[model samples]
Target chain A: MKKVRIGAGSGYAGDRIEPAIELLEKGNIDYLVFEALAERTIARENLDKLKDSSKGFNPLLEERMMRSLPIAKKKGIPIITNMGAANPESAGELICKIGEKLGLNNLKIAVIIGDDVMETINGYNTNLLETDEPLHTIEDKIESANAYLGADIIAKALTLGPDVVITGRVGDPSLFLAPMMHALNWSYDDYDKIGQGSVIGHLMECAGQITGGYFADPGYKDVPNLERLGFPICEVYEDGKAFITKVEASGGTVTTATCKEQMLYEIHDPSEYITPDCVVDFTNVTFKEVAKDKVEVIGGRAKPRTSTYKVSIGYRNGFIGEGQMSYGGPGAVSRAKLAGDIVKKRLSLRNVRTNHLQVDYIGIASLHQEASDWLENEPYEVRLRVAGITPQYDDAVKIGQEVETLLTNGPYGGAGDFKSVREIIAVLSILLPRDMVKTDIVIKELN
Target chain B: MKLREIAHCRAGDKGNTSNISVIPYDENHYEYLKQNLTIETVKAAFKDIVQGDIVRYDLPNIHAFNFVLYDALGGGVTTTLSMDIHGKSLSSIMCNINLPDIRD
Candidate 1:
């Protein structure tokens, strides 16, 4: 069994190349995985921004990954990423174009589709998988539908001699794990090996989670070179075990505690971790800190999988607007809460019904308000957050403007920051039956 | 059935559709809750408390239930926004159910 070096890149807002380029230049990694596409970034932009016809911020992220290809090719490293937000094909085509411009004729780009058919799937009448309401009734038209593709499609693309694979709606971990399966030629049913690889992917998906980004170590704050955080690297073996490490002399530490914290992320039950390909039993897994920057992972095993694939459905419901204000003064907490009431009252008087409204003091409890009994004390500063969506775009816009009015004469609460409000798009997730979904992997030669 | 137990419960679909799995605070008693509680009963209990139409289904041999509440938010699908920009809490509309009296 040959040792394969896998590198995972942390996803951040905007394009970042220095970290990945540094890894390729030094580590001589076999595979590079980049995870992008956060819900917050997507929700702020317009739908057209996601489409191939547009070259918005997301395309810039793809371009950043594409820029690394020339350097990667020089080092003979293959790259895979989920930078494809709404259009993987366009992203792939754009990558191929960049490869051509770079004069790398051998670049093979594979585009994975079938994940974007959310609208088509919603129209069909099928057994109500969960909701008795026919899928069509739940959605008039799907705004966006993406399939959380597993490693198999990526493995298939890698086997086809593609230097790069671009995918939309792939699980963040799958982006990194697929390369391991392809490099090792690991069987899909190899439960232990698959589970181990999945664990590695999980750790690396959120790049900083395994590093010191969320480290509880008291000294983490003093870790050197915070500006240039080094991404994580996985040294995978053929026996379904891997040691997660980072660049030598990297600024962050990879202790057992850090690795354990990463494992707990987005995890519901450690015992029954589900993925498209396998059910990873995280409870059986063990971790050992072998060195300063290394953590050995073992004991991962797979369980039977469900017959269906989880689908993320985004629909065109209506327009929404949100505005926030900062309050500072005596009784700021009370003042902010009162301001929220005033805004709601004014909107209702105008026959403008908002879907939701919330007010919170920054230092006080915002999410778990009822649970936070300590918020009774007045705080120095409070943030008033208000949000609403309506079928009529005009109504949503009006509500957004009304929130800005709070800064003028509406409330004497305190000084606050107000800016132009934007439109809110609707997003929903629905599961598609297994038989109805099939993944196709094709390798296209760079022109 | 204290609301706190399931109040922060998070549910999401796995495959290609929107099948939701509500994460109860206690996984050990998930089976007991599922067996005794049907979609109708759960919906009826909280119907007046929350918005949206209740839709539920039973899986084969798996003692769990999945439910989707249609138009639960005031504005239906359009009303709900992403968690990033907007700080408004969307899950507050759901009335918490207490199950202390039915404990084994």
Candidate 2:
């Protein structure tokens, strides 16, 4: 039976590259996939790209490529990655440059583009998926618009047989799915197999997340040696039945429990798990531990692919100001509460208006506080945080200033007062017809 | 007893909405969760942060429930100023719901 092993290197843009190096050195893997694009990361990259023409790709692209490319090249392992945040073309060029600097010759690179749809989005009168607000309302503030591309674009890039495939704004799972489809010679119409590949992609997309990296909770759900967490490698069969495991002599475990947790990580609906490839049915999925550290995944059904592509649109959404001060020792909770109260009162008195204001005593009750919160014993230490949002940057700054004023007016032991204001770009989604988004691949081989 | 004692969860956010998947630690408690983990209760548990309706999707094969919180996360990941921006920490709160003893 023909089977292939693919290693999931970096989960997100800033994910550590050391584990990826371990995967290359120890894990005899055929392909390495690094999913580095996040929705907000790309938006921020677009803003930077606007400021400087060549500044849009993942900021750590050079460091990541420099660190991992040579090792992967020496191992003869092809890499598939989306480190191409907003600029895959430039990212490709940079990768070529890195390989040359490493004395690597005859290395082929593929840069997939056209996921960005900022220029051609004017044709549709689309409304925001979350708020029903018209896209026209925020037209002037629009930063970048990118449609989540699928595995097909990646499959096309793979046909050229490049050592590395880089892309921008593609679906997270597509990074893994493309390699499976390309190597397995699966067609676009193979819904059931595509669904299985999608599930495999999801499990492997987050790298360590499925292998007990993010699932540990101390005594409740204990994971050992998380400090030396190992990334995941998948053994995918030609039949679309795959098992997940970690590199040899690495930390983290892959069990049925871990697989189940990652299966529905960000999924909204199991029956209609929509992706550019197909609507995957995660309801019937099953995981079985046929061997130690290897759990076989099966039974992912799929429906027809959607006709439209979901475009992630970023727009300037105003500014946020936050200030925090700590109080310790006896009566710390009360002192923090008093500081919060004072800041709220001062902000109101000073007419420092904001769209929203959140006054939290961090240690006492910031994450979980409601009308039903029962007053417990006073905390030993507490941090008072006052965060506010406003249309004007100056008003946003006032929110933090109000909290700073509490240094003298607040109760005793107020220390570590700090404040910061930042411009925010809220993300919104709109579906555009598939025809509106086009994909093109450019390949470069080291000479 | 607390729901955390019987179940474990993972959460993710998109835009202003958040989705939390709650699965019982033991498969025997699947039916119990399906019956007890209602939308009303989940909404009440996250009343402070979740502003919109909570829609629950039942997955019997996996013995899990995916609760989608609409209009939550305070303008989603990019715009939210919360320390835990992705709402990755919110699912543990979902696990803290008070559940009736399974013996009943």
Candidate 3:
């Protein structure tokens, strides 16, 4: 009959903390998790750490900890987060400092590390998961390499009875799964229970996503009160059966539609969802709308866990330069097309070396590219966007420069001309043997 | 009729690949989707953006079909020159697919 009410605090790093505050105040949850890290966030954090030794954790870590720490401590609810980004040790210290400022004494904070595998990565001749290319090809450009740690180590951190557990580059779902494993005392080798926990973690990891934040489509898939969207909560039982719901007074509805959408979101294979803990089979997963706002999730099968951990390698890929100019009036489409051509020709004349270039009429064929076609009635206005991927930073700037030239030189009635260039830190993945990487937890308690 | 009329979809990306899940508004339309939502139909619709293979996974228990498009995003979110790097808007495109009308 024992159950844990887990509340998803923040979905991503920059997610609003108000909903999380609501969860702590009204939800009466036992565990609160903040799934803050994204695929490229840690890499960007590593770059920050390179500049400043003390930097590299989530930018809003102080703000989040300052706001949530007192409430979570008062409620006796353990908090978990991947806000540590590239540096959990420093993040833990900062949290301790914030807790002291808040007058919170005896606040136990656990910082989990060892996801970074930059040193060990070079030793293995692993091939990139996406492409057949070996890791050696872009070794020089590597910025940060962190493996996706699973729930076992996180559960180990929980055994120490910490009020808050902060980690770097752990699997998004593992944050939620760890709490379940610790609370329910589930064995690591129990793939079935691990699979169920993984499903629950995956579903709750995105917070408001399952509660209609991204499910709104004007008339087709209408979600009400989205403006005040409430994050999701899972009332998970010891049996691994959980009810996905939200706070009653809050906005957003937790329905079967939203649950189904989130179940397969970002998942490649339905039956074979590979998490660090185990391989989940979501195909058999069932959602029953037992109530208006509560959907009962059941039946998530699984196989054994994989021996290797997926490491996300971030490296300097190139630079992307983009330029945009808007055109209006009766013949805007034609004018924009002409403007696009001018930018292309100008780039060629400037000898701008680019690996990939695209001249798109924004309103027409930008998103779908060749897949999109013109409408029957031509658009009265259009924005021409010229973007290119170049090896050198100077060449990237030239792409946008050419587009900027079209404001007066190439196209008529051009307005809102803009140009920007940014360095691309691309991410690639490789599988490293799990044994090669070791995770260590450092706990800091406010006395 | 359009797929949007009877079904809804959500698109998600991993590396260079994208997965779009199509779920029917009504459970009755599940069979209709399985029939008309063929690989060829999706391939033709996404011919421009998707450069790799398209595979569909069916989940009758949930009444949903997941379409996995490989090498979809120009190169992926970080490296791609395309404006919609994450391919988040690809769901809208999937909803725009044309479907045959069903008899009452």
- State each candidate's clash count: 23, 0, 1
* C-alpha-based local distance difference test score of model 2: 0.86
Judge the docking of candidate 3 as incorrect, acceptable, medium or high.
high
TM-score of each: 0.76, 0.96, 0.98
Interface RMSD of each: 9.1, 1.7, 0.8
| Least accurate 10 contiguous residues by lDDT in model 2 chain A | A366-375
Per-residue lDDT of model 2, residues A183-293, tens digit only: 888888999889999989988888999988889987788887888899999998888989899886688888887888888888887899888889989989888888878
Better of 2 and 3 by TM-score: 3
Provide chain B's TM-score, model 2: 0.95
How do the candidates rank by TM-score, highest first?
3, 2, 1
RMSD of 1: 7.8
Better of 2 and 3 by lDDT: 3
Q: Which portions of model 3 miss their true places by more than 4 Å? A: none
lDDT for position A283 in model 3: 78
lDDT of 3 by residue, A175-240 (tens): 998988888878888877889889999999999999998888887777888777889999988889
Q: Which run of 10 residues does model 1 chain B get worst, by summed lDDT?
A: B10-19
What is the clash count of model 3? Answer: 1
Q: Hey, what RMSD does candidate 3 come out at?
A: 1.2
What is the DockQ (computed on Cα atoms) for candidate 3? 0.89
Q: DockQ of every model listed? A: 0.09, 0.64, 0.89
For candidate 1, give the lDDT of residue A5: 89
